[model samples]
Target: MTHNVAILGASGYTGAELVRLISQHPDIQIAALAAERKAGMEMADVFPHLRHLSLPTLCKIGEIDFSTIDLCFCALPHKTSQEVISALPADLKIVDLSADFRLSDPEEYEKWYGNPHSAVEMQKEAVYGLTEFNREAIANARLVAGTGCNAATGQFVLRPLIAADVIDLDDIILDMKCAVSGAGRALKENLLHAELSEGYNAYALGSTHRHLGEFDEQFSAIAGRPVKVQFTPHLLPVNRGILATTYVKGDAKAIYAALEAAYKDEPFVELLPFGQGPSTHNVRGSNFVHIGVAEDRLEGRAIVIAALDNLTKGSSGQALQNANLMLGLEETAGLMMAPLFP
Candidate 1:
């Protein structure tokens, strides 16, 4: 029952991560690796940390026979994924880690991503890959769109609250800090060691972060109305993990109760005790998400926090989780490794 898998963008961080985790999977095998710019090179050359493992050489997407791939993880960048996936075999099950198919509406996709979606038909059929909330749909889906790391982290804290009506939808706010690797492995001047080493700063301020589109769409759907949260994202000096501190107007105990009840059966999401907060260090390099709840001194306000590795649980790990469901494999298989900590 081994599923032959192809990784479309295997040269990047998320793709390499998929290799790392899938390597440990008993029921999944890496059948092909595609990296357009680094074609013909060894994956080990592109990622020295993966040198010890026997892996396929990187090739252009078209060189591989998609007909043999049972499932493909499309880790290509935003717009790039749609084009590549649109041409892929129709029957090929896919877990897309890019932002391409995450938003359902093509108009909304254009609004956030600045371009009309190239694969409108496929986008319509794509299931949102928030593993915990969309388990049933993911199990039956041929194409699953992985959420943005930031979007996923924030929703882990707010979705249950919104669903239970325990929190005021109109006043929700999210302050998130993410490690640089969440930006992707692409080279940028700002991500260089000299520029990003010492201090942290915020970007996409004033409600401009693109992941807000996912928040607006998902929260509104849950509450049956337009729900927009004040979201501001910052880049941390660290290498991995994300911590989202959410402010909501609700009874503290009720918020915790709703979250606990919603995720009581979820394997990867862990809820911390009341008044205790989670740190990114606790979830680094793991597929686990830790959520914490606390009350503000003011009576009607409460705080909810969620933490996870931006690269693992946030992207590649999430893709792997969905792939498991689509293939009828154990959802937690190959993903039960403990978190890496100092």
Candidate 2:
């Protein structure tokens, strides 16, 4: 059986990525594409790379017929998604790719996002869309919230450790390097070629990155207490992927064991051999996550790393993963393509 899905913000990078992946899906079809600012323009024109494929002309969200859509992927921006999703059909199954529904508490959402969540009712029902950690719940959810690319990468390394009690919970540090595309396709002076090329710098320092809200919420839930990691994010000049290097006081053997056991059966997450590490180049343009663990100079300290394409596994691909389970389709369908590498 085939499913017809619509993309609510098809003009952006994530939306175009959804189109590229779904074009090869055996059980899903792109029914409509909406791009408010670019309404009435061809998707191909907006994204020249997609010119060869046939896709709907970008339309405003109001023009979409929600009833015909089996599921809708809302790739709209943070605050914008709340308003749009709040007004969407009540019965429409949705996989939101924005930060709008990711945090369960409206108060917490306001704390991190700087605005009260407008869709409190729907927010309460949304399932966190980390396919590895919350697969069963995602399968039955009508509203699935995709994790932030940075948040998702960090969790991939820490969740298992927290669950297995392999790492020192109170003293964890995450140093992340994210590609510029992770900032989104929106034009910004800092993202320009002249400004960003051959240069790298840290932005959200001193544990001020917004994704930390997710870390606090999820880690705390797992450990049954408040768990906050020292997190600092840097902007890399590269065009794709996120690599999170996490420091923890734990037995290297145990850290590797916990991670290995957790992702042993996960199709998209790969655990590198002990002492080996992963690079962003290995996971570009794919939903795969490569994790590695190594011992620090200090005997009890360990370093855990995780890497994935910020745009693919980090956002659009993750949205599709949840959308698959929500529709009762195989969780891995439409997402098994190999990573692009030089």
Candidate 3:
């Protein structure tokens, strides 16, 4: 019952993470690795931390034989993932870690990505891979769209509130901070040590961050109407987690009760004791998401905080979770690593 897996963009952070997790999986085997730019090089050359494990040499996607792989993890860039995944064999289970297939509407995809979706048929079949909320759908999907790290963080705190009518839909606001790895492994002048270290700043303001589209889509759908939350994200100098603090007009007791009740049976999601907030360090390197709730100084309002490793629960770990479902294995399999702490 071991699944043979391939990582299409094996040189990136998320792809390397998929390698790390799969290396420890008892029922999955790494069959192929593809990195268009790093083709023919050993995976260890691209990511030294992975040197201890036996792995395939990186190759181009076109060279992979889909018939040999039970599933593929598409960790390519947004626009690129759409094009690459579109050409992949239809019968292969795919967990796309890019923004390309997350949104259900093709027009919205073009609006956010600034390009038309080249694979409308596949886009229509891709299941939104928010494991907690879309488990059943993902379990049966041939293609699963992994969520944006930021979007996943915010949703863990707010989705239940929206579902239970515990928060005011119009007054929601999210202030999120993420580590540099969430930016991806690509070189960017702003992500350089001299520029990023020792400081933190917000970007994509004024409701312009693309992950907001996911928020709008999921929240609105849950409320059965158009719902928008004011969201702003900041880049922190560190390298691995996301802490999302949400401000909502709601009764603290009700909000706490709703979240606790909603995730009561979920393994990866933990609802902290009321009034106790979470720290990104607590969940770093693990697939677990911790959420906390507290009453705001303003009456009829509360603060909801959620924390997780942006690379793990937010990306690769989530992809693995969905893949387990698609393969009919236990959803939490190969994802039981505890968060790394200093």
Candidate 4:
């Protein structure tokens, strides 16, 4: 059962990652590669690291043969993904690595993205691709929306606590730090090596980061009430990974027990020993998320930390996990690689 796959934005960081992972997958074949600006060039020309594989030449999405592709990984940008996916064949199964279909509410989508959703019909059918929490929904979904990297990291730490009622819902705060690769392969003056290499700083202060829309929507639904957390993201100097430190109001022991109990049977999620925190380097380039819980200075309050490679567990790897479920393959197929260690 070799699944024939296509990547729509095959030249970006996440797109290249999808290629790297699928190239090693025993049950998946890279059938097509589409990069509008880089069309007509070989994948090796766009990414020399992938020179070893015999991949398809880059082309435009309009030129792809959807009838031959069993699955498509839409790695296009936010607004662009919706436009392109709207034009794709309705029968084609898709795992969109964009923000377009993540939020179920179109109004919320517009509020964050500043435009109406052009593909509302598909949005209604797309499952939120959290992999671990949404496994059953993803298995039956024709379209799956990959969660935002920061949102995924924060949720991995808080969702279990919320679900188990181990923490006070009104006082959750997520302070996350992410690597530069999460910004994608696009060029920006601020992203220049000289400017970003030696410094780290927080941005999107207050509740303004776009991934907050996902947190608001998902956490609220899980608690059967509105759940809003104060979230702030920092830009780190490194190239990959996300470390989310969460501050919650709860008993330290209960928080630790809740997280361990929730993910004890899950393969990709690892709960570190109580009182020990995780670091970004520990989960580099892998689908695993390591989480830890400890007591905060304030009584009855706990600090939770979660770490994972933003590009893997946070994006492409998560997409592959959902795809496995959709295809009825083993949920962990082609995703058993251990995290890169120093």
Candidate 5:
């Protein structure tokens, strides 16, 4: 009953996370690990935290024996993800944790990513990998496109309200704070400990963040009309979670009721008790998403807050969730670990 899987980009943050998580899967096994630049290195050398587990030595994608892999998780960056995925075996089941195939339109992909898609035909079959919302599609999909971490956090807050028509869609505003890990494990001057510690700043203001494309595409599709929200993302000094504070002009009780109904039966998403809000501290290192709704003193306004480990529920955990469905395995396998708390 075990499925063998391969992980591309095994040296990156998300890739290592996939390894850490899949190591515990009851029905899955990591048969191959690929990290183009770090090929031939032991995964233990690339990520010491995972040294306890016996894992395959990293190799290039071309070196993987696709015939033995039942599923593949690509944790590569945007453009590279598509290029590699396009060249992968057509029959390989892929869960891509990249922005490449999330957008359904090739033109929209070009607009946000600034280049023509290398695999336009592939987009037609890719399912957006927000597990809670796209479970059915993901179960049948060969290629599942994992959402942007910020996009996943925001949707956790807004998707229910939009679908239930409990909020003023045009006036929605999302102020999110994401930890540094969501930027990936790349070295950059801005991400230096000295440059980011004890300080925080906002980027991609004015709805310019690329994740906005996800918001537009998903929200608009749900409403059957154009629904654009004001989204602003901030970089926090911390290393692992995402907190999204959403402002919506709607009855607080109604918003709460809608969210409650939406996630009541869901395993990974928790809707807090009425008038209570969540903190990123509670959901760190777990696949769970904690969401809360508080009534603003001003009538017709409600504040909805959501939190999760950007590395877990935001990316790798989500990819694994979709992989479970795609493989016809239990959806929550290997993902119910309790959040790490100080």
Candidate 6:
């Protein structure tokens, strides 16, 4: 059966990405494109790369007939997402690509996002959308919150180890490098080509990065304790992908085995041979996540590295993955394409 889908915030990076992927999908049709600021503009005009494909013109959210939209992907920015999603039809299946519904508690949401959640009831119903870990919940959920790209990358490496108790939770550290597109399509002085092209620097030091909230909430829940890892994110000069190098105190061999066993049957996750590291290039433009494990020279230590396209597997691809479960479609539908390689 064909599912009619609407994409809100259709002009943003993730929103455009959803269009790109969904356009190629066999069971889903793009029925509406909502980009408030760019309403009435042709999608091809806004994104020349998409000019080859026929698509709906951008329009205001209210103009779209939700009665015809079987599913919606909300790629709107943080504060705005909650407000908009709160008013959608209660029965519509939604995959939200914002931080608005990630945290379970309103207090924690305010603590991290700096505002009270306006949709308390919706927050109570939204399922966390880490596809591999929360498959069952996502399948039954009316709303699924896509995790931050960095958070998704890090969790791909750490969640298994944490669950198996193979690592020391107190000493975990994550050093991640993310591409500029992960910052979204907004205009910013720091994201300028002249400024960001040749240099890379870390921001949100001292565990202040907002994704840390997701890490804290997810990891702690798995471990049944307060588990906070030291996380620092660096912005890379490239356009896509995320490479997260995690340091943990554990038996390297055991950690590798744990990860290998955890994702053995999972379709999107690939574990490299022991001691072999992954590069962002391998998973670029694909929904695949390549993970590697290296035994440090020091005994009882391991370095776990994970790589994936920040825009694909980290956001849009993830949203689509959850949408498949919600719609009772094949879990891997429209996402089996190979990575774009040089």
- Candidate 5: where are CA atoms >4 Å away? none
lDDT score of model 5? 0.94
| Model 4 clashing residue pairs (backbone) | none
Model 3: how far is 318 from its true place, Å?
0.2
- List TM-score per model, in order: 0.99, 0.99, 0.99, 0.99, 0.99, 0.99
Residue-wise lDDT of candidate 6 within 1-342, one digit each (tens)? 899999999999999999989988999999999999999999999999999989999999999999999999999999999999988998888999999999998999999989989998899999999999999999999999999999999999999999999999999999999999999999999999999998999999995789999999999999999999999999999999999999999999999999999999999999999999999999989999999999998899999999999999999999999999999999999998999996
lDDT string, candidate 3, 26-140, tens digits: 8899999999999999999999999999999999998998999999999999899988887888788999999999999999989887999888888889899999999899998
* Ranking 4 against 6 by TM-score, winner: 6
C-alpha displacement of 67 in model 5, angstroms?
Answer: 0.4
**Where's the lowest-lDDT run of ten residues in candidate 6?**
204-213
* 102 Cα displacement, candidate 5 (Å): 0.4
Which lDDT values do the candidates have, in the order given? 0.95, 0.93, 0.93, 0.93, 0.94, 0.95
User: Which pairs of residues collide in model 2?
Assistant: none
Over the stretch 89-165, how does candidate 5's per-residue lDDT look in tens digits? 99999999999999999999999989999999999999999999989999999999999999999998899999999
Model 4 TM-score, all chains together: 0.99
lDDT over C-alpha atoms for residue 45 of model 5:
90
Error of 4 at 33 (Å): 0.4
Model 5 RMSD, rounded to 1 decimal: 0.7
Report the C-alpha lDDT of model 1 over 236-341, residue by residue, as the tens digit. Answer: 9899999999999999999999999999999999999999999998998999999999999999999999999999999999999999999999999999999998
Q: What range of 10 consecutive residues in model 3 has the weakest lDDT sum?
A: 82-91
Q: What is the lDDT of residue 202 in candidate 3?
A: 96
**Candidate 6 residue pairs in backbone clash:** none
